[model samples]
Target: MSLLREAERCIANQGSHATLNALITTLQHLGPWLERVRDADTRRTQGTSKSAVDGRLIAIKDNICTRDLPTTCASNALDKFTSPFNATAVQQLEEAGAIVAGKSNLDEFGMGSHSINSRFGPVRSLRRNRDGESLSAGGSSGGSAVAVATAQCYAALGTDTGGSVRLPAAYTGTVGFKPSYGLISRWGVVAYANSLDTVGIIGKDVSSVREVFGVVNRPDSRDPTSLSSFTRSRIDSHLRSPALAARATSPLKIGVPLEYNISELSPSVLRAWSRSLAYMRRQGHTIHPVSLPTTTLALSAYYVLAPAEASSNLAKYDGVRYGTRSEGPNSATFPSGYLYASTRGVGFGSEVKRRILLGAFSLSADAMDNYFIQAQRVRRLVQHDFDAVFRAHQPIASGQPETNTNPEKDAVDVLICPTAPSSPPRISSLMDHNPRASPLDAYMNDVFTVPASLAGLPAISVPVTVESTIDSRDADLAGIQVIGQYGDDSLVLKVAELLDGRHL
Candidate 1:
């Protein structure tokens, strides 16, 4: 733990969580984390450094990029932008030695679930409320899961388009993940819904978010929606088949999404989703109960295809070539239509101008065939209802054919549910000057994380807890999730480390 005492214990947990603003550019000094711990101790005394996130630290998520901080996606339209480089997942986590413990805040371009539409405010939650206020840290990766749940950073880097990094790692308990949508590499992130952005992580477990998703998951080629090295070697030869290496040493059916048991959960998240499916059926694993039935129209087809691809990736943040240009009185007789309508009306945020006017009236032309072609045909029937209940086989459905398995009543391999149907609310009851706030009551907290981000699949979230006699710091932790199937994502991080018992 001596990378200078883990960067002085992550700068003393970022100065005791500094009022959980989580981070929006930090490491003002520690001289670049002590010059990368003295260049990893002079490359480990010349044997040449071996790095597996070597000096760790992490954070990131103010909307990815990061050539030395300030990627302010907690936007006043990229407020003083900064990134001239870095963000192939932050240059592969700074070439695997990690560091960058700053730039965390969000929900401006990433658009709120409750990081309270930041411009640099709201991202509080190390869980307070006994009238100590500070709650909703669940947002656009709520300051990267409250800086890895108050440790400040050992893991972060959020993005996940809908369910902004697993509803802030299930409202700040930690863990997150979200990989599998072009498996990590949205060439320096920033574009909100370019086919539902990904690149997620936020850790504290699931083996440090599967060791930073095995180092940026690979294959970028300047990310034209990355995922090709012959489709990641045909998803590593279909997970080393022989029926997926004998169903990975057996015992895992695990589905349970009977439409995510909604009744808006909350009886301690339906008792931590019935005690995490009764502890994964007492670990012999076999839960079934599947049926994705296009999961209640996958949150109205992900708020209409993620605001019609965030109204065409935020129309290149117009204000003459990307945001922050607002001068008024028709800047010299309509200078380029008043600096593109006063720099997106004084630089976004009011939930990014209500999702860019609901992604510009669902990509208008009289509501493009009833809301962007019926939300892209309900996002291909929510990816054909998760490739018809999982059982592996959907490495991007190439050459079709494999979904015919029965393995005991309609297949299954991952899927668990209940990431946010309650727990972590009270940031003044999702403020907007309260009065019973409503942006569809914060888009109903992304209804169980927008059906695995509208089926880009691979998910996570973890957290858990529940058995409460109260006061275990007021127990009820929640956030279950899991998902998978579209490149199974190492069976969704090995079934989220076997439902957080950390693979017991």
Candidate 2:
């Protein structure tokens, strides 16, 4: 079929609303890529068969480079920055026949938890509830989540450093999948933190998420961090599954973390969690009580380690080298390096500045052993805790399996828990939160999702229902997370599918 005919077919399936605003997305950077699609179709007709995302619209986060659009990290520091190259992920999407709809907004340098840190504006979480007020779309990938939820595109790509991708999925009630670190290539993506970064996929359903994941999960010769094929095979050999049965129908042993049952967790979230566990047990899955004692230290270690890496990565943005400059009282002293100081003072946002300072402090000579070294030790313990509980052995390790600390019969296959501590909070409340509790309260949002990140494991968040007694305005509710050991992404996604449903 002709390219125009294919475009028309996609529009027909989406109905009037989707057709009218097909190219307009959360952040307005570039659009209506009709020419790009025509070019792709011409190549397709002359060359080979179509791909999974042929003629589909997809949104790329602003942090990921695109030759056609500006690659601002949603901060004025790079307001005029446009890459001369396309990120490896974007190149893969185009090769698979997907068209770039536009670039989405995000927290400045992927910093904030809620999506309000952008210079462009905050991403508002909207739905069909017939209300004018919009709650937060979770951050640093908030705009990507909103784009998928509104059907602005077939799917979108987000980079998860901490809980950027999964937390937004929980708030917006969409499917967010963060593949195991190194599974997806990171070439040409602007660095936030080198070790923790993973390219994630967000879609309206698990099927779409899985389809897109298949296309990008390949070894990239250009990316130094991309996992080699040999390592991937070894990990697959250690995966847990019944003798010859496919994992989809096999009964699972799901772990519920005892530490997540804290005083701060809301009553509504607790009820929803209880209901999800009850439903899973009815389906004949075994439920086990588990403990990761290092889980409590996860948040503190992440803040230190992420900031330290970020400080080093962002050092190149001195006005003379990378970022834009600003006029100041000391502008006349350009050669003295004072102008670089003036430009950065005006360019960076409050949150970015805060993290950069904290990161720098952690890496300083006087504080290295006390802060940086201790944080590194804690990160290792977090990974060890995860390896000890799963049935499959850690492929990265060459020796025998580590001793299991749990007294249960065997290691659980997957860990299931609430994605967030509570439902989406009203925008008004967050803006007016007490001064003392503001930033710390925001940091707590990632508390449940960060453990998997520190371990470099694959994790996903799928929406589940909340209690009826909660107000109708609270309809957005919370999500349930399923985390798997390294290379166990397929099973993690399957468990999420089995658990997805409305209130039981």
Candidate 3:
């Protein structure tokens, strides 16, 4: 089909799926995207062939910058803001012939797990509970996952800072890929946690996610943290080595992190997890029960560290510099201090404000040692725990041997686990009036996905269908995460495809 035709079809789907609120802005906001599709169609008619992703429509999360569209972050603070230039990832994809469908809704500054904290309202899941109540699509990247799930777009871009992308994909029954840190440029993405934040891809399948990743996973001069070409070449070389190649073609060593089998896991999710592992075992792969003792501390450490970084990153939005300025008589008097106070008080949502406050306290002189600094130490231990079990040596960090020697016989090539602790939670359960709901309960959603983010490793969440006895739904889906050593993205995607039964 022509690019323009595909874009039109997606736009039509977006209108029909309006109840999901997957996109914050739609037809009216897609002028630039339509122009791009038209140009791509013109080029195609002229007999020009380009990238595999060319002519495909992809959704951009609100936090990612797009020059032509308002980059709201789903917060009133920047609700009307538009970037002067496109984000590096967005530009790279467009250069490769992809079209930006529109900006999707998100948690205010990507702060919440349920995506209910957005100024634009919550993103509803395509899936529902046994009671027939709507379910959360999962946060921060909830809208992107929904867009892909409902065929509103071919794929979508989401920023995963501690499993934002993966969790949403799990809820929405889509595939989400969070590539290794520094592989994708973060130049234009709004920061949540500098250390843990990563640009991720959500699509209907692993192949689609992999294709999108290939286009934007290049070193960018604008992003200081982006991995250098030399480092990338070294990683590529390591993967092509005889030992790695032999392991790739042969039966694999997959790890099952015992730490992830928490009591909070629902019965349905646990059953799905076992089914996924059993499928891999049937394919002749070995499953080794690995211990990542530090895994238990990862979630707590992430909250502290992410909020601290967020407080720093969000400080620039004090109305004077970036955020929306308040209206009324007191708004203009900067020396009076009312301007910054009123603007922010009215601009930020409850969840964003709560995080900002938590962050502020952690960074305070009296609390830094007990909180922020301790979190940093825990983060390091988390990284160490991952390095201990993976056979592939870290390419960026020298001094470590090329391959692990300790527990070498049991070292795993990849680890498989649940992406979220449970299936999609009921949307009503996240509301303020719910007596059972609390911030702590919301934080538990990230328990399974945070360890991989803290380690800066590559991970992908693939949807698995399991038999369901709930009403007439017939089947329920769970997200199974496949994690690999830093820079082992290709291997991780391969395993995800295998579990998806593509290779079988």
Candidates' lDDT values, in order? 0.79, 0.79, 0.89
Residues 225-281 of candidate 1: C-alpha lDDT, one tens digit per residue: 898789889778877777766777788888888777877677888888788888888
**Which prediction has more favorable TM-score, 1 or 3?**
3
Instruction: Give per-residue CA lDDT, model 2, range 269-373, as digits (tens).
Output: 787788788888998998998888998999999999999999999888877789777777654485764757877777888888889999999999999899999
Off by over 4 Å in 3: 1-5, 29-47, 328-330, 334-339, 468-473, 501-504
The Cα RMSD of model 1 versus the native structure comes to 21.4
Per-residue lDDT of model 3, residues 1-504, tens digit only: 787887888889999999899999764756776887788788788878467688888999999999878899999899689899999999999889988888998999999898899888899987877688999999889999999999999899999999999999888888999999999999999888888899999999999998999899999989998999998999999878787888866999999999999998898789888888888899899989999999899999999999999999998888888889888656787576576787888889899889999999999999999999999999999988998989887777768787776466878999999999888889998988899889998899999889999989999999888876565547668889999999999999999998662211
Error of 1 at 338 (Å): 3.3
Span of 10 residues, lowest total lDDT, candidate 3? 495-504
What are the TM-scores, per candidate, against the unseen true structure?
A: 0.36, 0.89, 0.95
Instruction: Predict model 2's lDDT versus the native.
Output: 0.79
Candidate 3 accuracy as lDDT: 0.89
TM-score of 2: 0.89
Sorted on lDDT, best first, the list reads 3, 2, 1
The TM-score, computed over Cα atoms with residue i paired to residue i, of candidate 3 is 0.95
